[model samples]
Structure formats: C-alpha cells, structure tokens
Target: MASPTRPGPAVAILLARGGSKGIPGKNLKPVGGLSLVARSVVAARQARSVAAIYVSTDDARIAAEAERYGARVIDRPAAIADDTATSESGWLHALGLIRADHPAVSRLVLLQCTSPFTTGADIDGCLAAMEDRQAACAVTVIEDHSFLWTSGPDGFGKGINHDEAGQRQRRQDLPPTWRESGAIYCVRVADFERVGRRFCGPVALYPVAHPPVEIDTPLDLRLCDMIARSGEDQTTGVADARLRPLKALVMDFDGVHTDDTASVDENGIESVTVSRSDGMGLELLKKSGRFRLLILSKERNPVVSRRAEKLGLECLQAREDKLAVLDEWLSGNGLSWEEVLYVGNDINDAGPMQRAGLGACPRDAHPSVVPLAGWVVPVDGGKGVLRAIADRLLALA
Candidate 1:
C-alpha cells in the first residue's frame, strides 16, 4: 500500500466489455435511469481521491457514452476483450497507456459497471483502507453465511465445512466468511505492474454493509430496475449545483401532485387522494421564502383549485398550452426560465420541463418525461413526490 502522501493522483479504470453472453449490450442498458457504464462514471466522479476516470471498452457506443459522462475512453483490443480474457489484461493495457501520459499516477482503482448500487463512498473507503492498512490492494466483500457442499465423482454430495457424521450445527456457530462483491478493486499501480497481478502482496478486504445488486442476467437487471423504480435503492440522490439557486418551483397537477388516478361513483362525482406529507413539504418550502410555487394543469377540475387553496399556492387550470401559460407567468413575475424548477409527468409537461433550468419528475412519471427530467424523485405522484423534491431543495439551501 502507498502512504497518505503518495505523490501521484489516483486514476479509476472502468472495464466494460461489449460482448456479454448472458445479456447483450448490458453495459448500455438503463438502470436507475442511468446506463450501467454511466453509473460507474458518476460514482467514480463522487470519489475525492479519484482524479481521473477512464473507461476501457471495444464498443464504440460504450466509448461515446463514457465520454458523455466525463470519462476518458480506451479502445481495448479485441484479443484482451474476449470472453475468456481476464480483466487483468485490460487493466494492464489501460494502465500502460495512462502511465505513459501521466507518470505521477500512483494508484489504480478498478470499478465494475455491473454493480449499479456501488457509491462514491465505497470507492473512497477502499482506497482509504488500502493506505490505512498498508496493503497492496483492497477489494470489496460481503459477509456470507450460507452452508457449502461439494459433489464427488460418484455424484454424492458431501459437506465441505461440517462432517457428515456430525449433527447439523447452528448457523450462528459457523465460522465467519466473506465473498467478493466484485464492486471495487483498489491497487498500488507500481506494485501491480511489478507483479503483473491485482493482488501481488498483502490484500485487505473492505466489507460493504449493504451491497448493491449486481447485473449478470436478465432477471438481475429486471430486479435492479424494479428496486430503483420503487425507490428502494439508496444511491439515487443526485447532487447538482443548479439545484441550489432555484428561485421558483412549478409542477403539473395530474401526475405531479396527484397519482394521475381518480375514483368516480355512479353519481358522477370524482375524488383523488393527496398526501399530507406532500403538503407539509410544500409548507416547509414556503417557509424558506426563496421560491414561488405554482401549479399548471390542463384539467378543469375543482379538485385542483381546492388542493391549491389548501396549500396556499396559485393554481392555473384548464390550460391546454402549459408552456405558453408558464412563459407568461414567468414574465409577469419578472423571472426567467433559468430561475424555475419545473416538475412534470407527461408529454404535455415536457415543453416546460425542457424550458426550465432544473427539470424534475416523480419516480412513476411517464417514460418520455423521465429522460428529460434533471432529477427523478424516488416517490410517486400524489404520494411523497413533492416532499422528496422539497427536501432535496432544502438540502441545497
């Protein structure tokens, strides 16, 4: 391991091979509203010790995406990118190129694109552990408590840990074990080159309390997508400087405020449920006295007016042209689109969302609006969407 005062910058290398047998183009697939490779790049950017990020891949699309997310691209050779090729070959080749241009680089952090839940803190922790323990490398691991078994040539199962003659032991009495999460690997560059391997000398295991899901098959990807959409993943917090200077907050009424659902009785009466937590969040935002909140809706329903009155916010309903109305309102208030944070859940709201400086949407918003949104809150509409956005704004304040 290197000392804390190591004279060079720590570079992070993310290897994403294009050819995946289990899932084709898996690296480019979206997870948590971000591509797998892009997620790795974003997490790497959050690490304070990582000065530069490089993506090694043979696919041109992956290269373009890596550059789009602020990472240098290394066009890996096909020989080293094949299914049988080990990651060490790609790392060595990429390191060779990086070291040629950056002679002062002292450490290398290898990040896997498959682990979408890996955070910047995890990467920093690995690097910190490496230096603190004076170990040649540090790898992320998770505690494992599963019993082990092995099959003999005769097709008989045998206990790998306990004796077959002994009675089954309690799980708590079993020895502690750890398994690699394949989320992160940090190594001393000099030692790595000298030994031609990641674990050339003493290795340290950095245990992750709750490891993010790893995408290997279609089911894994789907499970991760559901977790992200449900807001169960804790790594969705996005830190953008633009969120700090927000002066106004505009939202759509149907799906942004309500769940875009309504119940009607035979008497032709309609009712919608609204979250009290959302109202409290809005109240807190109003107390800040820094933002002007408004609701823009295309529906001409009294429910919209009633909810607005309860929240003490100005309501504009029966407006088919939300963008035009929003423009007029902004000009009347002596404000510009740059000061507004717009939240929408449908195509109609896309125009205003795109026009606003900071566009956001709820987790279950329309598919078309999700990509255009700068922030996709974890809560659904008529739920805690407003509260989530309000909390994010308050944090920035």
Candidate 2:
C-alpha cells in the first residue's frame, strides 16, 4: 500500500526475456497473431490504474517489441540476464529507474510475457484489489485441486491425496490449492522499495474465474494458441470491463474449417472429407476452459455431426443460410453475432463472415470473402489450415 496520505501514480513494468531453452525466442514467437510479449504490453496499456508502462529487457529485439506496444524501455543489466536471474530483480531495477526520475510513482504493476491469456480486466482487477483493500500486494490465482501430487522425504508417488479413493469426496470436501498464474501482480511501489521484495506484505488474492491459460513450455504455447481462437475477446474493453462469460464460438464448418472435399462411393454416397490434423486441433480448442464450440454448416452431412461429436463440438448442420441459423443461435443463446467469429473460405460464408465482429478466412478463400476477413489465415484448405489460422488468432489476440 502506498502511504495513505499521498497516493501517487501507478506504473506497469513488463519483463520480457527473449531467450528460452524450451522454445528459442519464445517471447518473440508469434502467438495467435501477435508476439507473446505484445499481449502483456497491450493489456497493461489498457489498464485504467496504470499510468505508465515500461519494459525491462537486455535483448534488443525484446526492447523493440516492448516499445512497439506502448511502453517505456529500461535496458536490463547483464548481471540479471541469464536464465537463473529472478524476475523480481529486473522489476526492482525498472522500479528504481522510474523512482529516480519520477518521485511521485506510487503503485507498480508487474506484467509477464509468458502469460498471454491475461486480459485488461485481469490487470485492472489486480490493481483494484490492491487499492480497494489497502493491501501492499495483489496477484492472480487459479484454484485447482483436481490433479495435484506431491512427494515427501520418502520419495514416493502421490495423488495430492492421502487416500486413492479421494475421488469419492465431493469437490468442496477437499482443500483447495492455489496456483500463481503469473498473469497480473500489483504492489505498492514504496513498500516494494522498502522491503526489496514483492510478496512480502499484506497481499490480496483475486481469483481469475474465467477461461485461463498460461504459456510456459512449447506444449503450453500450443494450448495457449488454441485458447486464442475461442473469440473470448469479443467484449469491448475486456480488461477494463466487468468480467463477462463467453458462451459459445459460432463457427462455419465448410470451407472455413474444412477443405471442402468430396468422394463418391459405389453406394452413391457423398463424403466431403476433412483434415485429420484440423479435427485434432479442434479437440484441443474444445479442451480450453472457456468456450462453447459449435459448428455451423449449410450442407447436411452425418459426417459433420460425427466429427463434431468426436471433437466434443456442437453441430448445427443442414442450414441453407448460415446467417439465419446464426440469428436463431443468438436468439436461443442470448448472444450477438458480433460476439462470434465466422471463419469461412467461400462466397456462401460471406453472410455470417460480415456478421461476426471477429471474422477469419482461409488463405485460399474466394476473392470475395478475402476482403471482408478480419484475419486471413496462411494455411491452404484440406491441410492444417484451421490449426494455422487458430494459432495466429490466439497469438494476435
């Protein structure tokens, strides 16, 4: 908490390390459609409480990215340049730099590049939590006790439970575990300087009770990439706005998600094939904590429903007009077309394509649909097109 008598301006310092062992240059690697570091920088810039944003890094490329997203640059010292360096050190350095020139800086927000899913609300919520409760620090927490395990001095296998039959206990019956999701952190600048630490004083915990994901390893990055395609960012001023639950992702199934292939059999059955990789990718997208994945196809085919069921996606098959179906979906589900992302690759898809606020098109989409696409993917149809597009959508967002 800043001195009660004189609360000063709030500043956000994002620390980005360009080098990574698991995924080289992961911070710079494109996620959804933007660099990993840019996600944090943009979120911080959008926070109401944050007055100034700064990026501290030793790498020139990282420094440039930070500046690109509207943040002051603080060249990190080499002593804290290696993998062994703690983020706390870099944060302190950037804080000191600010305090030296600007004595009125009161609160400091810490943003990380690894957690791309953190929205503007996450940042504001952390800062608000600190100020509202007069706490010295605040951070984002994800509650999980479902699949935890620990080892004691005996070095034995454990299920994060004493009894293997723990599944019989109700969810609330067991103790809850908190994981620091490295999304948002707020601290009183004065206290941070006084104690030379972040988590030392009276702290407030704000649970991120939405679809939350973190990018740590390559696998985590891939999962984060999947989360980006869910159209959760449909709300205007998401970070600053009150937390709103995203109900569904109304998607177009034909040329948008598939290659629009067909094969004739001896029985005179038409089977328009789909990409196996794209199907698997949708399964991953469905696994995200948030989003109601639905497939909207104008053509009637049992294969679409079968694939949707296998991927745990809802199928709205056999609709002549996707717009009419989208309207019914919104009416029944109490949503707006703008809240959805219509990914299409043909002229028939243009109706819903223009309706969704977040629209996407395949690289090989019809020329008519290309001009209306919010995101035109790079992959061709019938291949890993959806996955490639999904990856960019998540990163850009």
Clash counts for all predictions: 0, 14
Scored by TM-score, the top model is 1
lDDT of 1 by residue, 156-212 (tens): 988776666699888777778888888899999888989988887889889986544
Which 10-residue window of candidate 1 scores lowest in summed lDDT?
A: 231-240
Candidate number of the best lDDT? 1
Residue runs of model 2 more than 4 Å from their true location after superposition? 1-6, 152-167, 210-212, 233-397
- TM-scores of the candidates are 0.65, 0.58
Off by over 4 Å in 1: 1-7, 152-155, 211-213, 238-388, 391-397
Q: Residue 182: error of model 1 in Å?
A: 1.0
**C-alpha lDDT values of all predictions:** 0.84, 0.71
Q: Write the per-residue lDDT of candidate 2 for residues 244-335, one digit (tens) a residue.
A: 33345666776656677678799978677678788766666666544557788878877777777877777888888888878987888777
